[model samples]
Structure formats: structure tokens, C-alpha cells
Target: MSAVSAVATDRAQADAAVVVAWCDELADITAEPGRITRVYLSPEHARVNAVVGGWMRDAGLRTWQDAAGNLHGRVDGSTADARTLLLGSHLDTVVDAGRYDGIVGVLMAIRTVARLTAAGPLPSAVEVIAFSDEEGTRFGKALLGSSAVAGVWDDGWWDLEDGDGTTLRRAFTDFGLDPESVGTAAADPSTLIGYLEAHIEQGPYLDRAGQALGVVTSIASARRFSVEAVGEARHAGGTPYERRHDALLAAAEAALAVEGICRASQHIGTVGTMTVEPGAVNVVPGLARFSVDLRGEFDEGRDRVWDAITAAFDEIAVRRGVAVEPTEVHRAPAVFCAPALMDALRTGIVSTGEAAPPALFSRAGHDAMSLGLVTDVGMLFLRNPDGISHHPDEFVAEADIALGLDALAVAVRTLTERHGTGPDGVS
Candidate 1:
């Protein structure tokens, strides 16, 4: 190999070692049940964060906590007023959480900062965060910390109840974090030149495509609606089948309709969740309720899907002679990141002699989506073994981790050089 090729190969080998060490450290922090038992809200989560935070300190990063309990570690730059490049991932996990689901991106960022510090003088500031909550395991509200930074967190959010009936705000206080300090996490829109998040692909697309890195371009929006079908309760044998105003039947019709809508929409729709209440074998269901979740890359596509679903609901109500009502549970607008940032990430991947897949949107939500509203945003997905995530089996290979790290480092170098504000702030 030529000198340049040899140098690149050496870097790749070294970065792979870094990835292995990171994973080993995480395994040491996790529990044996971690493979099968859910890691959500366990003391183990906090333990790992503490250990990672200690590493951050040892690396000479200045650390602090916000009101939301988010941990921020700052790496100073040559320019005093440079807009900071923020990188982070959530620490919490779903039950039986995979070791690599979140901590990979965070640890990669930490390692990158450590390497940069050793090289001396950075063009722009870098801030690594372990966002307080993104998995929604504890509070059922995803993107909690990032929402605060975007200035979208409000009183209504404070009132949301957790599994223990504790308000999110109260939980914050109980955890020694003041709710009032949430505002301190607010980030100025322009001063944040860009936010980058590295995460496991959580899906099989990349592995099948034989790629290591994914450049995320947009985030899909979600529209969730709860539907209730009401009818007179009757004993299964007592009600004549023809005379029955069966709520359960109406719900079944609606469920199939939702599936049909998704199929007919040419793949622009999805109905991922449904539930029916008063579940009993003997009792004829007088009330049946379920939720319809719709996600799309564009607003117009989502509206079209919604129209189809509601139209089906109306038709079902008419045929079943039952009342049907749908209440919107949540609606999040689709978000697109800065095109320049996307281009830069692609460039970075190519510079490392790795292929960058075309940009794609996340099927699931993430903290980066929230930050996009307040800053330029971009994302990278490290390839997971089976494209699985949010579970204990979620995983990524060591080689893939190194590829992702090199791409991220390249992205940082390119962005800082092109957009660094110096001591003047966002210049």
C-alpha cells in the first residue's frame, strides 16, 4: 500500500480497537439479565452514565448537568465564540436493552474529542451530551431533554404521568433536578450551526445493503389517534347475532380498514399499534378502543393516509350502526435537516474511503428530530447486526463502529472548517 493508503488503514485498525474497548466497558456496566431482562429505568442505566461521565472528566472535558438531568461535557475550541457542534444519544433503553443501542454514538463522540484534544487546537467547540430521556421508558414522553433545548417543552408536558403516577416535573425534582432549570438548556437557534447524532441502524436495511454508515436526511412525522366504538353490552348467547350492535365487530372492521388503507396507499402509510378494552372471554364487548399510528415522510402524504383511515372509520360506523369517535393522541411534524450538513457527512464518509448510503428518515423518533427545529441537524447510523434495536439483542459489529467513528470525525473536521464562527459566534 502507498503511504497514504497505509496511514488510512492504520487509522481504521486503531479506531476498531477503540470501538471494542467501548463495548467492553459497557458490558462491564450492564447486568447478566441485560440479555433478556429489560434495562429500562433500572439502576444499571444510571450506573453506566456515571461511569461514562467519569471517563469524560478524565479526558479533560468540563462536565455539568441541566435541569432536565442531561449531562453535558464541553471540549473547548480555539475560537471563543464558535458555535458548538453538539453530538449525543439517549442513555435509557427498552427492556432487555442491547448494549450498543445508544451508548455507541456517545462514546464515539467522547473518543473523538479525546483524540482531537491530543492533537491540540480545535476550530470550533464540541459538546457531547447524554440526553436525559429519549426511549420514553420512564415518562412515556420521548425527546424530553431535546425538546427543552428546542424551547418546545411546556407546562402540559410537565403534567404527563409516568408508570408510578408521578408527574414528569415531580420526578425531575425527586431526582434532584429542578424543573425551572430546564430553560437553561435552551440553545440559540443560529448559534447551533449543526447537531449530529450517531446511532445504531436498528434495522436490517444497511446490513443487507452491505453499507456501514447511514446519512439521515429527514425525520418522519407521527399522527396517533385513539378510536372508541360503543354499543350496548350483552351476553354472548343472549344477543342475536343479526340484531347485535357489536362494538367489537366495529373495532375489527376499523382495524382491517387501517391495514387496507396502508396497503392501498402504495406504501406511504403504516398502522403499528392497536388495543381493545374490556378483554374478557364471556362478556360481549360493549366498548372497544384502539389506536391508529400513521407515519410519513411528508405532511401531504400523512394527510392523505389520515383521510383514508377516517373515511374507513365513518364507513364502519355506518355499517355497524355504532358510534365511533377518534381522539388524536399526538402529532409531530416531519422535520428535514440542513442540506449542507447532509452533504458534508457524505463527503466525510467518502473521504474515509467508505460508502455513504443515500439519506433516509427514521421510522422511530429520536432526540435529533427535536433539535432540528432549533439548529441545523444531521445523523449517522452505525450498522446493527440484524437491524434490530431498542431490545437486548440490538447490536453492531466492531468494524462497523470504527467505520461510523471515522465518518463522524470527518464530518466534524469538514463542518468546523467550513462553518466555524471563531470568537464572534456563528460567523
Candidate 2:
């Protein structure tokens, strides 16, 4: 091998070890005593910003915390005419979270920007943003930080309450931030060239394919609903099967129907949460409430499956003699990666002396979905073992992270050079 190739391989290995150590360091700043549970606008949030902000400054970048609580770092380009490229991902984690999910992406970007700056003048000013909230474990509102940056913050989100009954508005104030000033976090769309995020695949595809990285084609379109089944309550023993209208039975059937339809349709659906009313053990359940999370690659196809599921649910409700009602609580359309940015990432993966990387559509929603509202977005994914995530067992190899750092750094440079000299400029 050439001397240059050996040096590059060494750098990837060293950087991977450093980032894995950094992830371990951040995992210790959780609210729970022995688990990872960092949420939005809590003490952990502030502590992490300070910790990562110091690292950002050490990387020769100016750092600051946005009004919405997202931490940011910037390294300027060589020329005044140079464009800006956005990088990085969320810093928050879900309850009892794994070490890599959102954290690895941010650390990878920090190292990428450091590499770019150390190589001398760049054609674009690279900005690394560690968005404060993505998991929404606290307020039950995901992408809060990126939504603010995209200028899509809703006025009604302030009323959202955590499990502890503290209002989001109050939590903001307690975190030493004004609820009204979140608008200041929005970036002008004109200033950004595009957004590129490096994240763990959070699925088994890359590992199964034996690839270290993949380029994201798109983030899934998602819809969520709260479903309820209501029926007459009666004594469990006294009520005959002929006269029974058991809500719990009907709700269970509905949940099963969702699973069946999604499986047959090749879409993803989950009845993640469910509850039944009546405290007495001898009493039949008269009310059952459950949540349905449905996701797919396109809007129309996803909605079609929802239609099929709804029809199946209605049939189950009638057969069981219960009233079924479903309320749509949240919806986000599909976000596709730009072809140009995809090419840049493709170029980067190939630069690592590997074969052309495979492309995959993300089933999990990301902050990239929110950022896509304002600008073009692209993502590169490292392999996650067994596709485990949002759990304590989720894991990624250090060697994969090392490869990710090298790929991401090259992708940023490729993008910057292309955008600077492109025919249209800053697509």
C-alpha cells in the first residue's frame, strides 16, 4: 500500500477510538442513576452543551447555544464568497437509551470539521449543530430543536406536558430560556448550501450486507393515531359470551389486525401503547385505548395501508359489538435526499477504498425530516449491530465509526468543491 493510504487508514482507526470514548463520556450525564435518559431542556442538556461546546472550541470552531437549546459550532471558509454547509445531528437520547443513536453523529461531525479545518482553507464554512431534542422522551414532541431551526415551531407545543406534569413552557423557563425567543433559532434558508448528517443505520441492513456504510435515500413518512374501543361494562363472571361487549377483546383484535395488514402490505406498523379501564379484577373492561404508529416510504402507499387497517379495524369492532374511534395525532410526509448530495456521499464512501455503498430508505424518523422543510438534506449511516436501537443493547463497532469519520469528512469537501464551482451554484 502507498504511504498516503497507510496514513489515512491510521487516522480512521484513531478517530474511531476517540469518538467511541466521547460517546461513553456523554452517556454518564443522564437523569436516571444507572441508565441513559437525557431529555430536552433539562440539567443534562445544559451540561452536555458545555461539555461538547468546549470540544467544539478546541477544534478551532466558534461555538454557541441557540435559543432553542441546540448547540452549534462554526469554522469559516477561505473566501468571503464561500458557501455554508450544515452538518451534525441530535445530542439527546431516549429513555434507557443506547450510546450511539444520536450521539455518534454529532461526534463524527465534530471530528469531520476538525479534519477539514486542519487541512487549511475550505470552500465552504462548515457548521456543526447538536440539536437539543430529537427523541422527545420528555415533552412527547420529537424534532423540537430542528423544527425551530426550520422555522416551523408550532404555538401549541408550549402546552405539551411531561410525565411529571410540568408544562413545556415552564420547563423552558426553568432551563434559563425564554419560550418566546425560540424563533431566533431559525436559520435563513438562503445562507445554507445543504444539510448532511452522519448517523448509525439503526437497522440490520448494513450489518447483514457486510457493509460499513450506506447512503440514505429518504426518511420515512409517518402517521400516528390514538384508538379507542368502548363497550358496556359488566361482571366478568355474570356476563354471558352471547351478551358480552368486551372492549379489551375488541381492542386486542384491532391491534392484531394492524399487525396483519402491515405485514401483508409490506409496511411498518406498531401498537406500541395500550391501556384498559376498570380497577376491579372481576369487572369486564368497558374502555380500551391504544396507540398506532404507521410508517412507509411514500405518502399515498402509507395512507392506503392505513385505509386497509381502518377497514379491518371497523370490521373487528362491529363483530365484537364495540364502538371504535381513531384520532390522528401526528403526521409527517416523506423527505427525499437530493441527488447531488447523494452523489457526494457516494463519492465519499468510495474514497474509503471500499466498493460502492448500498443505499437504503430510513424507516426511523430523523431530525433530517424536520430540516428538509427548509433545505436539502442527506445522510450517511454506519452499521448498527442486529439493528438494535433505542435500547440499552444498541451497539456500533469502533472501526465502523472510524470509517464513517473519514467518509463524512471527504463528503463535506466533495460537496463544498462541487457547490463552489457548479453551474447553478449552491443547489
- Model 2 agreement with the true structure over 255-286: per-residue lDDT tens digits: 99999999998999999999998847998899
Error of 1 at 11 (Å): 4.1
What's the TM-score of each model vs. the native?
A: 0.90, 0.96
What RMSD value applies to candidate 2?
Answer: 2.5
User: How does residue 235 of candidate 2 score in lDDT?
Assistant: 98
What would you estimate as the lDDT of candidate 2?
0.88
lDDT of each: 0.74, 0.88
Compared with the true structure, what per-residue lDDT tens digits does model 1 show for residues 1-427? Answer: 1111312345655866776686666766654543532233345656766777887897779987666667788887687777788888877666566767667878888877776677886778888988767777667667777787788887788888877788877777766667777788887776666888888886787777667777887787778788889876777787787777778889888888888887777534444555555667766778888778787878788888888788888988888878888898778888887787787778767766654355667776788888877787888876776787777677777766666677778888788777768433222
Off by over 4 Å in 2: 1-8, 420-427
What shift in Å separates residue 313 of candidate 1 from its native position after superposition? Answer: 1.1
Give the Å shift of residue 293 in candidate 1: 1.7
Q: Give the local distance difference test score of model 1.
A: 0.74
- What is the lDDT, from 0 to 100, of the residue 424 in candidate 1? 38
